[model samples]
Structures are given as structure tokens and as C-alpha cells.
Target chain A: MTEPAVTGTGTGTRAAPKLVLDNVVKDFSTRRRKTVRAIDGIDIEVGDGEIVCLVGASGCGKSTLLNIVAGLEQPTSGRVTIDGETIVGPGPDRGMVFQSYSLYPWRTVSENVAFGLECIGMPRKDRAERVQELLGIIGLARFADNHPKELSGGMRQRVAIARALAPEPDILLLDEPFGALDAQTRRAMQEFLLLVWQRTRATILFVTHDIEEAILLATRIYVLSSHPGRIVEEITVPFGANRGPSVLRDPRFLDLRDEIQELLTTQVER
Target chain B: MTDTSLQPVPGSGPRTRSGTGASNLGDDPAAPWRRTAKSGSRGRKQGVLFRLRDEIPLRHRILLAVIGVASIFVFWLLAATLWSSGNVLVPTPLAAWKAFIDYWQSGELSTDLWASLVRVAEGYALSMAVGIVLGVAIGSFRSVEAFWESPIGFLRYIPATALTPLFLLWLGIDETPKIALIIAGTVFYNILMIADVTRAVPRELITASYTLGASRLRVLTRVILPHSLPGIIDVGRINLAAAWLMLVVAELLAAQNGLGYRLVQLQRFHQVDGMFAILLIFAVIGICSDLALRGLRTLVAPWARP
Candidate 1:
């Protein structure tokens, strides 16, 4: 109903944003010759090293939006650019982690992490080193020789994250990475992700349905309305660095969580 | 010091020393109940034979299998001796064994076995090489599938047996026709089955590989092929039976030497015992090869196994 917000460069004084989605729209055509727009007229800018979260109800096309950013699916009409370059197809510049933890089951943990490097023709010695370093970072060094099937759900997701980070992509795109985990594990993973972000300082565009999770992890949150998905609100979190579970108890966090929850419920009622 | 030595060790209680210290077994309070529990478990282990979906011990399984095979032989013996009334038409077990020994002593068994095996190997190996390439292509690429779909659909229906006369006409009575017949019988099925297996690879794996900076070729070679390997072996295993059937058909129709040719000659001379021996050999070879392929599957694609 209104023009989506097109924010300026970033929180910092950078000349250009790290990632940009301009007037992004995606439509699917049914076999009966009817058109259904999944997401419409979206515009967003994620700064360098920023953890942005897109929050919405189911069928709000949040995952679709992430896929568009990952370049796995093309937008019906729009442009997505990273560092002033338009993305034509999937490349190593963007890393993706799906909710399903899409690790190659046949390969061991280290080999799965080394896949991208192998794709780029990296030397065996260097690939092994990078894979080892990542295994240590994920606290899964002991599981380096095990296959994906041998790991628990949380460990597999961690390996998936390490795999996406293997190529050292300019940005990380995670589509509800912990959506399948139990609530307790999800909270732990949230904390673990913050630590990983703090360590890698990688730019992230995260999607999730949990409002509190968005509030906890995101620098800025985008809330989308369902049934022809569209962004209705953008809230920039007011928090300093060094985030932890303690932030969940912060009074400011409570206020922001309520506000986003109300906004989502109103969208559902409409 | 002498009194301490006479006393039982402190940590080594009655239960620990009960097996060697017979006097402790009667003194221990829990010994009766523990013995009952152990006997109960032993009873349950014996009941495993009748329990639904329970695992049998390896030795028991082997014993059962031997009984199964022996029962078949017993039935054959009854049919030959009782029903036929001393006639050699059905050939008793001893008669077939004698025929087997005679053939082995004359070295005809090895020669015929080698001849049939080599033809099947060459034909099946060629089919596997060609089938895998074509199957992967057809499964991976839409255009390749489209181009080959209709022709293969029409050709597979026309039985390979119907083409034997044409094969002999085109390639003559030499080994060429026999080998060609085996290939014709199996290659089509291999291509279709393997294509189905390759198509079953998860789409997300391919997408994930692409995002990881892999090219199309690398994705096929590293991801799809490895993922589909177990199913491919299964397909190869199944189609090998068809290859053997075609080999026999080719040899039966025309051949200088092979198990199938030997069977034809034995039949003409009314050597029913020799025929039974050859058929037994065929069954044994078929089963052994099927098991070998299964082993190969486990070796190459351990991830596919449970």
C-alpha cells in the first residue's frame, strides 16, 4: 500500500551497502494460467558485517526472499547486487545454509566443509588446513572424520554453517538455520551463532519466524505480511556489541519484542 | 598377618569369587536370583527363533539354510526314485553327482564354464560402460532424455530374443552374435534402471554444490554419481540375470562350446543326469554373482547401507 523503505548506505559511513535488493518481486504461475505473486516490491540494504533478520509468518515468502538473495532462484523483476556487482547466478561470494542442513551425506565432516575449496581447485594441503580450522571453530573437531548421519541435528547444522563459511563468502544467507531444533537447542544455537558472527565478522541475512530470535540476533529486523508478501515494518535494534543470553532479560528487549509481536498479529488479523 | 591372609579379600566379595569359590555360591544371598535371571535370559535367547522380526544367530541361520537346500534335494530324490520307478528320466541326486564328477574328470566342465563366463563378462561389461554414460546423460539433461526417450521406449518392448535370428544373420555364427545378443538383452534395461536411480538424487544437494562454487560437471561427477552408485550397482546386479538368460538363449540356438551348448548336446543324447548337473551349476553361478555385486555395492557406497 505504501512505498517500501529504501534506506541509505548503512549504519557506518560506507559509500555503498554490502548487499542491496531493489524492487524485488517474484510471481509463480499455476498450470491453470493464473498468476500468484509470492513477494512484491521489496527493497532492502544490508551493510557490511551486519546481521539482518527477515521475520514473518508462514507463507510470507521470507525463505523465497532469502533464496533470491542466494541466487538459487531468480526474481521475477528486480536486481540484487553485492558490492556493486549484480548477481547473475550462484557463486562463492554468497554462502547459504538451509534449514535442512544440506550436507553431502557421503562425505566426512571435514570433506563436506572442504567442498567449496575443492570446487575452486584449492590445493589439498590448504583445503585440509581450512577445514581443520573451521572444525575447531564449530567445536566439532572430534567429529571431523564422521559422516553427517552420525551427528545429531544441532551438530549437523553446525557443520552446515561451517561448510557455508568454508569459501569465506562475502555474505552468509541462512534460511531459518535453527528452525528445526528444539527450543532449548535453538537458544543455545542462537548464542553460538552470535559467537560465530563475532569471530568471523561475516555479513549475514537471516530469516526466521520467531520474533524474539530476530530481536536477539539482528541489527535490523524486517517484518513481512503474508498472502502476497510485502515488508510492512523495519526496526533497528538498540544494543551494543558483546550480546549474550542476558540481552533476552533486558527491558528494552522486552519492549521491542512486544512491538514486533503486535505488528505481526495485526498483519494476521488483516 | 596369618589371620589377614586367611580372611577373604575385602573388594573381592562373594559374587566376584563365586565362580571359582564354590563355597561362596551357597553363602551368597543374591546368587539364587542371579542364577534364575541368567537361565531366564538363556530361555529367551532360544525363543528368538519364533519371535517376530528377531535376529537369528549366524550359526543358526546357516544351519537353516542348509536344511532348506537339503530339503530340495530330498524332494528331487523322491520324485526321481519313487515317481519314475527306477527310470533315469528325473535323475536322482547321486546320478547327477556322478555326471558332475565325470564331466569334471574329463575337463569339459571347466572349458564350458569358462566359455560362457567370458562371453557374459564381455557383453555385460560393455553394456555397463555404455549404459552408465547414457543413463547419466539422459537423467541429468532434459534434451538428452527427450532425444532418446521414444526410441528406447519402442526398442525395449521388442524382446531381445526376437533379434537373435537377425543378430546371427548380421554377425554370423561366431562369438560376435552371442556377445551381441547378451548386450541387446541387458543394455536397455540397465540404461533405464540406472537413469531412474540417477534421477532420484536430491535436488538440494545439487543446489548446495552450486552455491559452494562447483561447476555443473563437478556436481555431476562428485555429487550425483556418488549418490546414485549403490542404486546403480543394484540395477547392474538385477540386469546381470537377464544377461545370463540371453547368453543361454544364444548358446542354445547356436554355439561351438558353452554350458548351454553342452546342455543341448546332453539333451540330444538323452543324458538327463548331465542336464540336471549343468542347471545346478547355472543356479549356483547366478546366486554367487548376485552376492558378489551386493558386496561391491557395500564396498563402494558404504553410506547407502543402513
Candidate 2:
């Protein structure tokens, strides 16, 4: 895909292309010490305020790619850069949401959101204000004191997003944010996420196995190949404004969904 | 044929009921219980008199209580019957209770209890201080972990009682060895328990803390310690019980005055009631301390389930 051309959204200030991954590769050794590659020679760039969704099969290594970008894992070779700096380790600039609602079970929702801020030595008053704001944005204001276990799955995911956004990071890394929710809740969360992104306009790197979700939320989608994830296809989805639940019923969406599915199926069999 | 007008035929047309003295029962003032049955899951509310705990439910609490009480009663009955032969050392429950009151009035029991408690307090305090420090260090440092794992595991399984004679020889028959024995016996378990818990803290949580701009030392203090607190308290509870066991053994080896010393002296003279009185006192202390430790654990870890 060509560089994302900056278009004025009437916000006066456009976000920069904040995160870039160049020819990144990652591998792991099993118990028997045999090496298994996860991400293979994949290059991606996430512009500020852009939503970049990665679509792949089970072993396509999209999740691994996100982890590398998050700095939770080191790439076996190549490099990742954020805001013109070589990424060495995890930092506050890249906030991540795991596939599982990885909210600390022992912490209340508000505390979980404030955790990053607390680590960075934010004063109690400021942390509390930031947490309250995020909670309000996620529509979990009443659940501030509730633990993760008490929350429904979708609610937990909202809290996770709120937590990642609380740090006001330059980029957001999400590993299948709505993968665990039921179909109805998943659709609702997709719309909810879009609203969150529109409000904050933080760069997002979302990994998912669902083609429909990729089409719904992503400004651009990257299709990954199976086994040592390689970029097989990349496309720009030209979704107009006022997209929501009605987008799924659009005839064009079904046709694009089928094409992606057939492509992935053939690649998997091969 | 006799009451045809009142009864009618068996195969008559649909029978119509006269309006009862009441309206729909649900709409009545005292009909809340009727609606409760219709609400859902009626079985859940049955036999609530037995539901003593929110989590344990009625059935489990009832079963546990029955078994515990029956076991105690059965053991006391058997001991009484067997001791009637004058061969067994068991004292009758009444005789033991009488001795307990006598000692309490005379104040001898208070001294013995105090002496034992003081020794346990000193030894356990020392053990806790050293154990937690060493455990955290070894658990976090890979080199230390590798070096201590085998030796610690071996020491954990060895009985503290078996080491009493050796501690007596090394530290002598004074309060020194008695205190030393308790410390030696208890500290190893606490260290291993804390170390195991410290090592089990999730790597992601620590990394998350680091990514949020926390230093390594800060992560250790804030994230690692708080996360491992439940496990630390768990081991602390277990050590409290173990410390008491070691205290008695240490006293038996060498001590002039303690609950253990009094029990042994009374036993030699066949003063079964006196011995029984000391045993009962010991049991009370053991039980109360266990309850206190459990309460502390719950307070420290409000999020943890009992």
C-alpha cells in the first residue's frame, strides 16, 4: 500500500506516522530445542490516528507480530521503530491489549486503568482523574470499583481498551480485542472501538483472525500467510462515514469477505 | 340417587368453581412467599437455617461440622473407657477439666503458658525476619535459586523433632537451644515457601510495570511483593502451626519450666490429670494462634479466597 496520504479531518492537527516495523522476524525454540519461526520478514507502518488491522489464520503469527511491536518480545532479526527511535523494550508509548481480558484479577477496574500511570509515578489526584475520564469514555463509570471477575467478557474488553488508552500512548496494540465475546457483543464492541479511536485518534495495530472485523474497523488490512507469518496481501478498505451495524448488511462487504476467505483457504491447504 | 340435586352426575358438564374467599394469592398482602417460589430456583432457598457461610454453602458446612464434632466425641469416649483399665495414660474428660481449673486458680498454669509463648514468640519472630528476606533474594536471583533449591528441598522434608537432640547438643539445655531449635525448625520452611511464591509471580505483570517506566527495584518492591503476599501469608500460617510443634519438642529435650516440661513431669508421677491439663492448655493456645494467623492472612489478602 502507498503511504497514507494526509487528509484534513477538520481537527486542524494531523497525527504523524508514529510507529514503523522494518523487516521484523521472530522465532521460538520448543522443549526439544527445535526452532520455530513466528513472524517472517514482515514490514508494516502505523500512522498516527490510523487503524491498521492484521488478518491471518491460526498460526499466521499476527499476534506474535503485535508482541514484537509492543516490545514484549525481541525480534530474532531486523528492527522496530516508533517515533524515529529504535524500540528496545516495552514503554508507555505503546499500550497493549491482550486477546484475553488481561486485566489483573486482583485490581479494581479503576486501579487497573491507573496502573500504568502509577508506575510512571503520576500523583494520586492526576491518576484518579485520568482513570475517571477513561471509565466515563468506556461507559464503565459505575463499574469503577468492580473487579475483573465480576465483569461480563465484553465489559472486561472495554475496560482493557480504556486501560490501554488511559496512558494516552502514541500507539495502541490490540491482540484480537473482541475475539472472546459473543457475536452480538463482538459487533457492539467493534462499533464501540471505532468510537474510541475516533475520539482519541491514537494509532491502532489490531490483530484478528476474522475478515469481517478487519473490514469493519480497519482503514487498511494486511492479510498474513500461514506458518511463519508473511504478508500475503494488503488492501485499503474505503468505508464511508456513518458506518456501524448497517455496514455488515452492505452487499459489497459480503463479496469482499468471500474473496478473502477463499484466498486464506487456498493458502492454508497449500 | 339420595343426593342427586347437590352432587349431580359424575360425567356432568364442566364444573364451575365458586369464588374463594380471596383474590389471586400473589396480589394478597401476606403472599410474598408464594411469589418467591414462582420466581426461580426454589431449591436454593431450602434449609437456609444450616447455611452458615456465604461461600461454603449449607451442605458442606453441615457435613464438616458433623464429622468434626463426632470425631472429637468419639475419641474422648474411647480414651475414657480405655483409661479405666489403668494401663493407658488417658485421663477422663471430667478429670482433665477439674485439673485445668485447679491449675488456673493456683496460677502455675499461667507461668508455664507464658514461658512457652515467650520462647515461641522470640524464635518465630527471628525466623520470619530472616526467612522472608532470604526467600525473596533467592527466589528472584537465578544463581541463588539454582544453588539453594536442592538443599532447601531436602531440609524441608526432614522432621524438626528429629533435629531436637542435635540442637540440644549444639546449643545446650538452656533457653538458648530451645529457642534455637524452634528457629532452625521453622525458618527453612518459611524461606522455601516464600521463595516458591516469589518465583511464581507472573513475568508479564513485572514487565508491564517496567514498560510503564518503573525501575527494576521498583518493580520488585511494588509488583512482585504485593502479588506474592497471599503466598507469603499462606506459608506464614503453616509456619505458625509448625513453630508450636517444634516448641513442644524443644521443651521436651531441655527446659526447666514450660507446658511441655510440666506434662512430662506429671506423666512420670502418673498424675494424669495434671498432664491432661497441660495438654488441654497447649491445644487451646494452638487453636487460638491458628485462628489469629488465619485472620491476619485474610486481612493482608482481602482479594484472596479462603
**Best of the candidates, TM-score:** 1
Who wins the lDDT comparison?
Answer: 1
Q: Given candidate 1, what's the lDDT at residue B41?
A: 19
Q: Write the per-residue lDDT of candidate 2 for residues B1-306, one digit (tens) a residue.
A: 223344434333222122332332233445555443332122234354454654565787799899998898689879788767656767777888898898889888888889999999999999988888889878888888889888988887888788888888887888888888788889998898899899998775665565555667877787778878888877887888778888888877678888888888877888888887787787788778778877887787677664
Q: Candidate 1, residues B175-220: lDDT per residue as tens digits?
A: 9999999999999999999899999988878888988999999999
Pairs that clash in candidate 1: none
User: Fnat of each prediction?
Assistant: 0.70, 0.30
Worst 10 residues of 2 chain B by lDDT: B13-22
Alpha-carbon RMSD, each predicted model: 10.1, 10.0
In terms of docking quality, how is candidate 1 classified?
medium
Task: Please give the interface root mean square deviation for model 1, in Å.
Answer: 0.7
Q: Pick the candidate with the highest DockQ.
A: 1
Ten-residue stretch with the least lDDT total in model 1 chain B: B36-45
